[model samples]
Target: MTGPGMLTALWLTPLIGALLVVVLPSGARRAARPLALATSLLVLGLAVALTVGFDPGGDTHQFVETRPWIPAFGATYSLGVDGIALVLVLLTAGLMPLLLLAGWHDADGSAPSDEGEHDGGEHDGKRDRKKDDDEVGAAGRRAQVYPALMLATQALALVAFTSLDVLLFYVAFEAMLIPLYFLIGGFGGRVSDGVDRAAAAVRFLIYNLLGGLVMLAAVIGLYVLTARAGLGAGGAGTFDYRIITAAIGDGRLEIPPGVALLLFAGFTLAFAIKAPLWPFHTWLPGAAVAATPASAVLMMAVVDKVGTFAMLRYSLPLFPDAASTAAPVLVTLAVISIVYGGVMAIAQTDLLRLIAYASISHFGFIVLGVFARTEQSAAGSALYMVNHGIATAALFLVAAFLVRRRGTREIGRFGGVQQVAPVLAGVFLVAGLATLSLPGLAPFVSEFLVFVGTFGPYPVAAVLATSTFVLAAIYILWTYQRVMGGPVAPGLEGTPDLGLRERVVVLPLVGALLVLGFYPQPALDVIEPAVAHTVELVGGVR
Candidate 1:
């Protein structure tokens, strides 16, 4: 039998973990990391179980749960997962534990602590100076708050991914911001080059909130349309996705072209800002540069997927005609993002900012595939989301390790790192290769599928976007050579290599990319049906 309440359990586990973290005595704060890790592990187990139980051939949502939540507004506490949602959920669940492990020591260093109480005569003046530095680090780190916010964000993300009610999705979408805002504003990375973490957080919040407000208006408009068409629950407008999708699909509800396009723009704009497409993506570099590595992974690799996910789940399916009409413009923007992000990445001295730009380029490929509207490309786009999470997480985590070692993110600060930390160098190289879509890596298959699929319908755009491959190699390998290949820089001789814990944290991400690279069929099998259905909804070809 299908596991009942499995979906509820998936999200609730993390929410409860956050609550536990909050209630734990301050002295017990050390327990927070283990608690968060255990909670994430549980969620991962549930996600894997859900995946194994899922019938890949089935077209409908699995493990469905629904209850009246805001019936006055026709919203429900609904949750379910199709293949698309399942994979993204799996990505989120899988990454959380790794991120926690990667940040373990960093978190400890970040926690507030009394470093001044060392035993008398045991601490020398030099040791006292080091102790003072440690204290500063601890003062900057919000160990308990970081993990708690991460869990909270995960809960909201799961809700956004699984919710079948449009209103519920919006609520989860907006709710996710609170924890992330604090994470960025409160526990952000070392400020460098005048990039203020608080300002970055504020910018992120303003842009997203504006997009959300626009989307809220569109949601209301959709509710009114369905109501006037007598297409929802009790013939009143409903926010139920099933009812709305059915009404639109069956022609029971009709929306004017102008109104449909307007609504489409509302949704698309919001998703784009979150996706951080081209011009809209201005907030991401600063945010990514300012936030902690764990926070960056959560935001970029997992949370940002929501934007593109919404586009595929709601935008294209709900407004096919508008999507079709706007495909050229969207595709153009995607191409620009691809080129612009890559070129900008090549110019970045900050490693985190470089990764952020790389993500913009990668997101361009995903958006291109989604708007391409073919089954293969769309499925590739879905798979790309998962692979990007794996690859980007690996890159960011490794970079975080490097930064922690060197005490700087400036690319110019180090040289010949590989000579000392060969294993660390090796892992960083693999992650960089994956980002560039090197053959035999997980990202290649997905990137290839995207190109092949896009070429069939939008060859010119495809050709232009392909230039990103060259740019990617330039930035990735050039950075590698400069940072790791040159003679060992002075004062860098003692930089420790990847320890057992760091290796454990990174190996899974690298292993995932390798395994999925050679054997993508299993993931593709799960994604194909959902993609086919989506294409059908958009009146696109297989």
Candidate 2:
């Protein structure tokens, strides 16, 4: 009970676990699975404790931990939880263990092969068996890396969210790209279908790294501005977000509005690429399609949230005047992403890719709400992040299960699934409905809030954005009809329903979605103060 505080432990737990996993011996693969799971669970428990112990009545960083990491550069090891970081942190913790469990496989469980047969007469069987063995090996390798890197990514993201110092936050923010690069390239590259997984990985890295490099420049610029502010004669600029925030507030650090726009553009490019708004989203569908269900879930549910989170945390607060001036343009992009993602999703034959595009559409809502600059919209954006994570995780998990059984994500490859896997189909229905923002579900409340707040300020954009629902419903129901309603596919006549392990992994997410849908007040209550504070910080620019 008297262990490390929430923020400290959250940062260290996964780092320690990741290091242990790397050093683990050859025979320790089995242990690696459980160790990773335990570490993730422990982090989750700490997050829950933090949530329970959180003071909903007040809005400030809680469970604070700060230490001088580099005194000369003005960087520090600083961390604390506000509502936005807190919810995202908890969601990260919740999903890492599930990724591990879904990917778990024993050595003996590998597919058997006939390559060792002694006669030419067995050639056909031999070829078939080798295919099976290769499939097993590929899956095994994926299982090992996906979950481990996911935890590492979570660790980096948590650090980014909690860090009070600008340089530290920037480092953490950029460091996350490394694991995710591997997640998409290394983990996704190995999947058996579609264009080369490596190709998809390369595309993902090239686009994201380009965005990251731009952010690096902005970070240095901000540091220079901060360092020049205080010391009388000659002072080296510092890269501390809190110090910079204070400097900006006092009007001591005056950046040319054009320079501010340039820096904002850098940061915006990075987050937008990650959020995958409109034109920049081409890498996403391929990455998701090539990735395993577990990997897709982590990428869509947790990793993408980093972009939205950075926009809210860094961009708007650091460059409020610029953000306000650019809101109209950004909102336009959000509207296009909404419709474009939905339309493209409807055309995808592949289940994984469809879900990926759908997420693009959903993310448009989050961006719209943030830029709308209303308390209600900001609060809704915050809640939508949590809701999206849960709904997406559920959808991807079910999609993964279906792919394993049918050996394809093609809508044409599946049919009458509900008759065979009633439970799975039911869960899929729930996830799909949540995506459509059906009344009584998590997305409904959040999406409604986004529209309500944005419509007042950007009515046309809001109305155009609402078309996403029609588009979303079209894709979701189309998928359902193609995959679940007709007579069962040839090889899937007796497909197994969700196993106990799969159920154990998925049920919690389902319950979470339902609970949040009904009583989102807890998350909303905690975020209101932070949202208001953020709005006020940006409002001062005018």
Candidate 3:
């Protein structure tokens, strides 16, 4: 039995860390680093403890902590995790400390440069000289702020995933944007050519904010409906997901099928923009190009999962009939996104942009699997989310390393990289193979299941999607040849290999992908029950 105190601590730990990091003085910059790392590590330990405590046989929400938060609005400071969410939560926690380590040096560096191999004494001397120079600039003055904000972003993300109260979840969801906006705007981008990180941040914010505002309206509407049904005596209009899910399940909260569709449209629209499916995907290429590797991984791998997770957890269950009615429309958009994103990937010269477009194509597959509405499809979709996160994170880390060494993101700028940095090229190869769903990699099984399940119900869409996988091979292999196998580009001589720190950070992601690929039963077993619950909830109404 998880206590309310433990649940509250889980949410507050990061938030409190954010504030502490923000206030830490510039003179105490090194001290702040440990604080951020410690906070994330503690959170990770807590999450692991959560898993050990979790009962595999129990499909219901575990570690529930409920208490009145706002009596007037029927909101509570409630938190719980099911098996499906528990896995994701663990993944999220596990990733954060590594990300913190990845960004530790540059989080506060205004004019960031890749750290070079050096003996400890020499490195310390160089760092001292750099710090002395930095002390004279505005960059030094703001060093503490960015790192603190980064930690804050991680904390808020954790809160959003764990919150049982829908309104609290929404708040955490929106709150996370504030720190990320600063991270991209303040700390990321190509510093050499004076790339405008500020512009990219603004673009990221405007696109997301527009969608979030619409979601706000839909959220309010849900509360109003809950109130009309006399939930919580109509005083507070319960915003607890469990309560709302129960009400919808019991036939107490009824809305016209048309109105339900409209509300779901709002919710789905916000998620789609985040998923950045096809036409709504323009923001991603820019943001990914502008962001630091660590930030991009979090944005693409973890943050984007929010949309798909919400679709599974909220949209389908609450409005089953509407979801069914809208399935074909969503599927159409998804298929178009599949072909369009792949075609765009074929056109990209920039490695970062290519990865961004790849995500768009992959997202289409995820959407296809989810909306196909078969049990296997949904289960595959869930597992695909985890698989994609691990693979994409690995790919982005490799790309960032390439950029650091070669001073370019252009595919045309490099060739025969494998000759110089065989280890690095090998990492890229494995990650690319995983991206293409090669057998014995994480995505292969999940993708195969998606095609198997969906082709039965959506043969045409599945056929079109299968073609995208062929295109996936084209873009992935094409880029690989240009960057790794052809003539080594001039002046990229003696490029350093992956450092110990990078290997320590990325190897886990690669290992997880392989482990899950070969044996996904552990994840499948956990997610199937949740997927079945959702399928039954939605399938019953249909």
Candidate 4:
């Protein structure tokens, strides 16, 4: 089980599936979704199997695989998973089948709008006619690509999580943007009533590309330094992650302080933009709101986790001393992200944007845990990644269902939703509670660990971060009250509760939130050891 083939299958199954979807003939296009779903389900099976086979107390990187990807460039196609990488990989794989299910009909033909546009009929202007035709024409083609893109995203994310070569990881990291850009632009959930989806998509791509471009330079610089240090065989530079981390961990490799600072900054900036900390976060809300709920979940829950995960995997271990010195500054930014996102979320009129901002706040907590550098904080950060994915998927996807029924995302437009759609309202409440890290839920455990861990080293920052708890309650409960409490809002009079398909999409996520909430030890057990190893590296940075 711990070999080249098992890990390769984890990513290859989906990549092959995506290619299969793309090649489907028009006549067999109807089978596209089922085929894609089957492929995701298969990938999920592989992930579960891999998880079972993983020996947490065993090697740091299990299911190890390596092949020469580029000999002259000193890059190898290497893949493996330590406990930290394992959990994130599991998170990515676990969510795909669900995301595919969540966006089940996102590519289907849209229903006619309530506006009487068809009444204009042949008398309508040419502009209206062409728009209508374009809308109709977008359906079939988009359906084929929709699942294909999702599969591609999942494939790249898996590779990113497991890659042991900096070049391999960077390639997968940047490639993820393409599918997501299209998802936001073409399959938008009608962000703020269909305004600026394309703009949002372009912004998402541009912002991430900038971050990646800077990282590319840092990567090249690090490789040259390694080659000069002769860390590779016969003085050949190597992009091997294991070789670099081992060299850096021991006294064998010493990077100049200034150069290390520059390199670490390059790496952290990319991750910050990806994690979307503060100023770099403007792109996140639009992308999240524009993409369909399932795609939004993929972006935030699965895709965004890569950014935070990379911070743990690459940033800290690769540039230990630099990270040690930078921790205070990074923690300060995390605190700012916490307070600012919480404040912004409280002010949002759009449900999706509000959720997106809330995620920014949550990511702040995760980063705080990571840089806190204690065993408790690092382990918490890893566990937080998994729990956050579940909570966000449930919260955001439930809201999507509600907004779909009401035909609007404006918060002020709804009230007393519980009277008509009790299940929807109830589930939404639980999901919201999870987001706010309410006690006895999964998120509370991780959030609590992060606070306790950070308090020992950064007490003021820890206290400041506590502000999110109150802010979260305000936004989560107030939104719930406005949308689901009091007298029913106009046009929601007979709103239906969760349908079979919608329930299928939501119930499992809700259940996962509860199950992990009550008992998160199993996840923590697997995450702690890897975190301890990483802490050892950072701790000895001097």
Backbone clashes in each candidate structure, one number apiece?
1, 3, 1, 1
lDDT, candidate 3, 430-460, per-residue tens: 9998999999999998899889878877899
Candidate 3 residue-wise lDDT at 51: 77
Which predicted model would earn the best lDDT?
A: 4
> What alpha-carbon RMSD in Å does predicted model 4 have with respect to the real structure?
2.8
- Candidate 2 on 1-542: residue-level lDDT in tens? 32346687787899888777656665565566777788888888877888887786764777777787877766678787788888888888888888778866522244322234356565697797896677766555544555678778888888887877767877887788788777666544233455466678789888988998998899888776776675212476666666676677778888889989999999999999988787799988888876556777777888788889888888898898899888898999999989998999999988878999999999999998889988888888989999999999998888888887887778898999999999999999999999999988898889998898898889999899999889999999999988888888788888999999999888888898899999989888888888887888788211
User: Estimated TM-score per prediction?
Assistant: 0.94, 0.91, 0.92, 0.95
Q: What is the C-alpha lDDT of each candidate?
A: 0.88, 0.81, 0.81, 0.89
User: Cα RMSD for candidate 2?
Assistant: 3.9
List candidate 1 segments past 4 Å from native.
Answer: 109-141, 192-195
lDDT of 4 by residue, 309-389 (tens): 999999999998999899999999999999999999999999989999999999999999998888888888899999999
Between the candidate structures 1 and 4, which one is better when assessed by TM-score? 4
lDDT of 3: 0.81
**In candidate 3, which residue pairs get closer than 3 Å at backbone N, Cα or C atoms, i.e. clash?**
73-236
Could you tell me how far off, in angstroms, the CA of residue 117 lies in candidate 2 after the best superposition?
14
Cα lDDT tens digits, model 1, 1-542, are 24788899999999999888767776676787888899999999988898889999875688989999876667788888988999999999999999888767545553422233447588889988887787654543456767889999999999999999899999998899899898787765644444587889999999999999999999999888878987656867788887777777899878899999999999999899988798899989988877778888899998899999999999998898899999999999999999999999999998878999999999999999999998888998999999999999999889889977898888999899999999999999999999999999999999899998899889999999889889999999999998899899887899999999999999999999999999999999888888888898888768
